[model samples]
Target: MLIIATYDVCTTTAAGRKRLRRVAKVCESIGQRVQHSVFECTVTDMQFEELERKLLAEIDQTKDNLRFYRITEPVDLRVKQYGCFRAIDFNAPLIV
Candidate 1:
């Protein structure tokens, strides 16, 4: 499944900044960043569970906002994109 993870971490404090970096690191390990605070992750059910757990641990519920969106299959039909930033096609064969 494809998971879209987005986060808004309060950066008014040093701790908040640190949490933001930690959150980004976790997402980067499993997915490609689509925007400054948005990531596109392709993972299995088990991986999603673990990812969610890690994210939940890094965020402060009182100060941060986190979300996960599961994109149904036939993703091309569900997601539309424009501009120069083209997302990688996970199903395509790797040339390098």
Candidate 2:
């Protein structure tokens, strides 16, 4: 399955991107940040749960927020139509 995660730093700061990177890494090769703070992950239900937990752990409720949408398959096409991410292969190595 695929999950589209969109997030924002309510109070922008250098720490925001750092925290976001930490969270993004937890998803392993299944996740990638398409925009500054938004991410997309493709994984099984179990992996997705792990990713969500990791993201929540890194977030500062006082300073950051996220929204997630899940879809099974065809995630690349969906992203292309929305003009957000270029078609991405989630199986690729982590960009970090």
Number of the top-ranking candidate, with TM-score as the measure: 1
**For each candidate, C-alpha RMSD in Å?**
0.8, 5.1
lDDT for each of the candidates? 0.97, 0.70
How far out, in Å, is residue 54 in model 2? 0.6
Best by lDDT: 1
What are the clashing pairs of model 1? none
lDDT of 1 at 72: 100
Model 2 Cα RMSD, Å? 5.1
Error of 2 at 10 (Å): 4.6
Q: Give the alpha carbon lDDT tens digit for every residue of 1-96 in model 2.
A: 778877665446788878767656654356776666566777778987877787788888788887788875565456454565475664688797
Give lDDT tens digits, candidate 1, residues 1-96.
999999999999999999999999999999999999999999999999999999999999999999999999989899999998999988899998
